[model samples]
Target chain A: MTSEIRQFLFESLTVMKYSTADMDDDTVLGPAGADLESLALAELSLRVEDHFGVRFEEDEAEMFAAMTVGEFCAEVARRVQTASAT
Target chain B: MSRGVAVTGIGLVSPVGTVVEEVFDAVCAGRSALVRPPEGHALHGVVDVAAIGPAIDPESVIPPKDARVVDRSIVMAVRAAEDALADAAIEVGRDVDPYRVAIVLSGVGGLETLARQAVERSTRGRLGISPFMLPGVLPNMAAARVAIKFGVRGYTSSSGTACAAGGQSIGEAVRILRSGEADVVVCGCTEAPLFPTFADAFGNALALARGWADPTAASRPFDRRRNGFVLGEGAGVLVLERAEFARARGATVHAQVLGWGATSDGYHPTTPRPDGSSAAESMRLALRDAGLSTADIGYLNAHGTGTKAGDAAETMAIRGVYGDDMPPVSSTKGVTGHMLGASGVVEASIAIMALRKGVLPPTHNLDDPDPACDLDHVRGEPRTTDVAAVMSNSFGFGGHNVSVILGRAGG
Candidate 1:
């Protein structure tokens, strides 16, 4: 699940036209790293929601930008587990 | 009689070309961009025919992710605006004051985006709506996006004068410059009404060209067999600066906007006044403002939309204004199809190019001119003449009429 989440994360960023070459576990998604803005983060969150069947709020999507790629993937995996268990 | 507005740069996106010179060459060579939407086209099987401009590469202008959210129409306008600025070699805050530049663009609001989004939301419910939908569907977003992208801080406006919007926007730019509100003005319009739903409106109203075997032959303005105007999608942008401002900056001058006139029919919403008295007044007002008489114009780019009543009314209007010595006239719509609001600036750019080349482009499909539209129609082939000045007119639904006069720089 973690690896799949990571793959989806990189693929989404790539499709969004962000270069993920230098990105890794420590790189954040916001200005500190990939520099995705509010709209872009919202779009990325929606894409994840569509793919994983896990929902996210608008405010939660903005918080995604502050998380590192590793942390984001982990958060998504936790949400998917919680959504499917219910 | 009027302040000379210098056209320093032109960016034109049409069925023929995107570069001003390329579009000019195709128009001069009489190549038609009108064609039936090919299979798999979004409008294919919906509208019988149209003049579709080249598809813009979204990634070129916006980030791939953001491209999906921003309206296609806005991106195209921004690209054209950028090209116009590059052509003029003017940079806000560096070459000219950022606060002294105005952006006035116009078009039928975002029918394409709105119609499509409405469909998606209907099928999927509330969550289907995108966050950027509101800004994408706003009519003023064209001018707003241009102003935002370029950091233009001066007066920004959008005209909703229907088909006359493009001309009125330029007229408004001249007013803004003359008001001492701006030094350089970015003026133009963008339209992308190619959706199936939008096509249905014109198709149902019987306002679209139909039953033509060949799409290129669909739009025949002033021709005896003329039926209706073919829908076209594109944008036109031009950078206009004060004549002295352009001269001081040593910018290349494409043409000089000597004068402009705008009027209303007060008759009908969709149909023009049959007697064309109000339309003729528009021409006379333009001439009066330019301090030129009827004999001064070398060619007239008419608002002949190939419709039965529109061509006749415009012809009567021209005859009422110029009578027997009417200048050589043509309607490039036979080649470009009707671009609706975008036609005015595109036609004005074509007229400017015609003046510069001393060659008048002929009406593409005007093989048999109607007796009602009788005048010296430039047809069969391009006419070679040392024309110094030209006129381009645009009339829209709701009776809006605009006539703009262009002349060789300092002529």
Candidate 2:
């Protein structure tokens, strides 16, 4: 599950044109190197929606803030699983 | 603050041609550069691509390492800026102070590279993402990169007011110069949103023309059969300098930017106000800024995107602003299609050329003009007329309305 989450995160960053070579699960995403701008983040959200078939609450945007690749994937996976269970 | 700004140099990269000379010739001859997309692309009408000349090389303007970080839109802006600066004979690092130079670029779509990367990641997983994605995807990065490339250290900014971005950028640049923030301002817009997702979005909205096999006939602005606007990509740049500065430097002036006005409808996200109040107000304010009455203006470069609502709204706006004594108006979009954010600057440049050459280019493919659009649209061939002052209009999504007035150099 952790590896699956990591794979998802990797794919997300790749789509944003960020190099994921040095990125680990713990790598920070912010205004730093891996940080996506507001427009990019919005686009990323749409992609996530299309990929996972799960609708995220607009308030979850704050949760995305400062999230590392692994954390983002885990959150997405959690939401996806919860949505599926429902 | 009291003085006007002079357009010292102009550069254009459009469907008509890449360079200013080529574009000017095409404009004068009333040639259409709209072409049908390749099969299976799922686009309607014409798609205008950058007319890259064989003699010019992209590598000459941008190094390979730096070029990779930028999208096609940024590349077009840099290329146009280079041409304008060279044409003006402004000696960089010598006669010009880098600190006094500013860059204001307007665009709608930022780095489409990021969006494409997102798609790839969704299908192939995180391992497929590129390292340089973040820096390449930001909208402001284009202006930032242009400033770095040109060594401009002062007042670097960008505007993204949809299609009105270009006009607003130029107006802001002029204000910057007038306000003494910068002595020389490089103002323009570039956009290349021909990506799959963008096409899907526009197509889904029914904003793109469909079922038109012939490109030239697809973007028929003000014509009865006009279905929608064609998507186009290009850049147009103008060097705006204080009139006094231009005179002091003995630079050749193209035209005087007399006044500019911008406003928002606060109405719809995509559709403009049916009453055209906001658009008319912008034109009135622009005329007021120029200290000229509507009677002084000779021609108008319209923001005619070939859309049903847009065309009708703009027509109502023009009639409201100019009343029964409306000037001859034409939409270059008939030939160039809709250039999105770059359309404002491109059409403004065309207006400047018309003022200089004393010839108004016809609205190509407007064989049957709509009775609703009652303005005297120069049809078929270009017309020879003494144009003293001209008004250019650009209204964007989100109800952004911008108007700018330009006059002959001496006028």
Candidate 3:
């Protein structure tokens, strides 16, 4: 599951034209690192939700602000597990 | 006459060609770009024929991910904007003040995106609606995306006046420049109405050309046998700058935007006012705005959509304005078909080219002139004459009317 999330994130960022070579667990995803614009980030979120069959709540949307790619994957994985458990 | 607003550069993506010179040359040669849809085209049997051009690969202009969200119409606008800026030799952030450069793009809105999203939502439920849907489908996205891409911070606006939107956009840009709000304005229109749903709308309305054996002859404007317009899709953009500013920058002045006039018919929603009074008033206002008399005009690039009503009404309007001494006139729609919102700018650019090249573009396929449209119609062969001043007219659904005049730069 972790490997799938990482692959998805890498591919999504690549589609946004971000270099995926240096990205890893500690790599920032927002203002601190790739500096993805609002549209790009929204797109990334949508792609992740579509992949994992999970939904990002309104309150949890802002969680992407300072989140790194690794942190994003972990949160998404957690949501996927929760959805399946339900 | 007031010193004209300089048209420094023109960019066009039409059925004719992508480049201004290439399309203008095609226009002068009376080459028809209208073609039969390939087998299994969405609108192949539905519309019988159209003036569909080469498919635009959005990924070629923008990143694949970004292109996935933006409308194809906006992509066409971006291509034309790039060409226009390059032709003017003006770099927005470096050469010109980003805040002082404005944009006025107009179109048929984003019907393609709306249709796709609507279908998705209906089929897959609420979660299927993409977050990018609104931004992708808005008409103003054309202007917004151009500003975002080119860093144009000055006044930006989008007009949605159907076919008249293009002419209105250029006229509004001239107003903005005259008001001293912006030194340079990139103005034009883009339309991608070739989709199946959009084509059906026009087809159901009985507004599109039909039953033509040769698709190339589908759009025969001003011809006696003309039935209706051939639906087309493309964009046309022009770089309008103050005359002094353009001269200071040493830009190549294509022509001068001399005057603009807009009015409403208030007669019918789809059909034009048969009296042609309002359209004539629009042209008269354009002439009045330019401070010129009827005799000063040399040529007219007509909004001849080949519809029986539209062609006759426009002819009546011309007779009302020019009377017996009508100027040599033609309709390039015969070649490129009706581009809807983009038609206004495309025809305007062709008019400017006519002024610069001393050649009057012929109305292709106008082998037999309609008796009602009895004017000095340039047909068959292109007329090589020193055209100094020209007028381009665009009338849209809902009775919107606009006329713009262009003159030889410093002539």
iRMSD in angstroms, per model: 2.5, 8.5, 2.9
Q: Proportion of native contacts in model 2?
A: 0.00
**B1-411 in candidate 2: lDDT tens per residue?**
556799988877788886665676686676777766555443332233212222234456776545555567767778888777776667546757888888898786455787778888898775346545765676776677778777888788889898999999888987898898777888988887766667667767888766676767888788888888888888888888888877889999989999989989899999999888999999999999889999988889999998888888899999999997788899988788788888898899889988998888888888999987778888888889998999999999999999999999988
In terms of docking quality, how is candidate 1 classified? acceptable
Question: In model 3, which runs have C-alpha deviations exceeding 4 angstroms?
Answer: A12-19, B1-3, B40-42
Model 1 lDDT tens row, A1-85: 9999888889988877789999998889998899988877877887788788888976898898789989999999999999989
The residue-by-residue lDDT of candidate 1 on B123-218, one tens digit each, is 966556666677788999988878877889988989999889888888888887777778899998888888888788878877888899988889
The local lDDT score (0 to 100) that residue B237 gets in candidate 2 is 84
User: Once model 2 is optimally superposed onto the true structure by TM-score, how far is the C-alpha of residue B76 displaced, in angstroms?
Assistant: 0.9
Docking quality category of candidate 2 according to DockQ thresholds: incorrect
lDDT for each residue of candidate 3 in B85-112, tens digit (9 for 90 to 100): 8899899988789999999999977888
For each candidate, the DockQ is 0.33, 0.04, 0.41
- Total clashes for model 1: 0
Estimate TM-scores for all models: 0.92, 0.80, 0.95
- What ranking emerges by lDDT with the best candidate at the front? 3, 1, 2
Answer with 1 or 3, whichever has the higher lDDT.
Answer: 3
Task: Report the backbone clash tally of model 2.
Answer: 10
